[model samples]
Target: MQSANLQKQKLELIEKIIHTDDQNTLDFLKSILNDETSDYELTDEQKQIVEEATAKYYSGEEPSFTWDEVKNNIRKRNFQD
Candidate 1:
């Protein structure tokens, strides 16, 4: 109930902000909105890394762990401290 009220307040404030003629405020808001929805494009190096990893996985050259093994490993590490 409290969260709903907060969300409503935020929407009202954003609606007010969207109508302002202030350039600086508008630019700041544009940046915030852009950051929220920005799609990150992978660089050539990053693409190459991903492709190599995929190849290794498909070739079974990369080691894989089952869920049970992972849980056991985590339990062991937690008790080691």
Candidate 2:
């Protein structure tokens, strides 16, 4: 997209946000704007899992699933009704 179009879309979004009366919507926007990576802390076990996953990803030692495959797998596992 062009920069001009991006700026126009942003302005439209800002206008919509300004006119929105829902407190939940406003709070969501505020949280999104204020959110930072530093706000999240991972436990030691979670960190170890992430490091292992990262290594496997970089080394191509594990297979990957497409979005469709992942969703289908989840449905098969969890939505057996």
Candidate 3:
């Protein structure tokens, strides 16, 4: 309900932006759109770490925790120091 209204408002704002003749505003909007659509590139070391984690997960070498346990652990850590 609230989400639908927000979506409608976004569409209305976008329509207004589309009809604008301001070059600076249009260029700023284009840059923002490009940034949003761009893919995130990870460094080699970061990629290696992600690959290692993926391998561990697929090899059943990674420890898995339930959502409730994870939340409880987070709460404990947050409350403690």
Candidate 4:
């Protein structure tokens, strides 16, 4: 396809996404948002943290937390004075 045609198609799709209230459309958008690449563009400090976590993971010395524990920690953090 030509570049202009592809751009036009992309714009139409984006307009549909913006205007539609359908459940499936919302779910599809959610899946796109949940993609790892779609999440925050990591800062240098965040990149370092991820690298350290990966090394610890490979070393078998990493700490593990359950989803509930993580959620609880987040809740506590949000409520902190």
Candidate 5:
């Protein structure tokens, strides 16, 4: 099928779906349209962080923290009555 025809079909289908399931269809459309491609551009710091994580994973040197360690840290932060 041609791209134009496909787009028209999609629009018609979306309209029908919206009419039948207004809230869900609106939410789906909102989610689809809310994506700001430009805003998702990664910063230099984020890029470096991703690179570091990738390097750690590839080098088999990723740091591992246990659940007990997390619980202990959180417990220490709590003040007992």
Candidate 6:
């Protein structure tokens, strides 16, 4: 099932690449396939924070909210009449 989905995705990407004429976009996609080096890096402290947060979320120790819940809370706070 996953393989079928992946093949579909690959075909869609191939179609897009064939139809795309923008040199910059082609260059960016080429770099994605060719580049091995990643430029983004996090500091030790930042990495620790992220790891802790992920652990808490997975362990059900942290509260999580949906996008709608977040927007409603923001509106309640800002739009009181």
Over the stretch 1-81, how does candidate 6's per-residue lDDT look in tens digits?
Answer: 569889999999999999998998997888789974756699999999999999999999999999999999999989985
- Top candidate on TM-score is 6
Note the Cα lDDT for every prediction shown: 0.89, 0.89, 0.89, 0.86, 0.79, 0.92
Which candidate gets the maximum lDDT versus the true structure? 6
lDDT of 5 by residue, 1-81 (tens): 579989999899877876775686676667778973433588899999999999998888986568999888778889552
- Pairs that collide in candidate 4 are none
Cα misplacement distance, residue 81 of candidate 4 (Å): 72
Give the C-alpha lDDT of model 6: 0.92
Model 4 error, position 42 (Å): 36
lDDT of 2: 0.89
Q: Write the per-residue lDDT of candidate 2 for residues 1-81, one digit (tens) a residue.
A: 579989999999999998999998987788889882335689999999999999998899998889999999999989786
Model 4: residues with Cα > 4 Å off, grouped in runs: 32-81
lDDT of 2 at 60: 97
Name the regions of candidate 1 deviating beyond 4 angstroms.
Answer: 1-38, 66-68
Give the per-residue lDDT digits (tens) of candidate 1, residues 1-81. Answer: 579889999999889997898997887788887876645699999999999999998999998889999999999999998
Which model, 2 or 6, shows the larger TM-score? 6
Model 5 alpha-carbon drift over 4 Å, by segment: 1-29, 33-38, 63-81
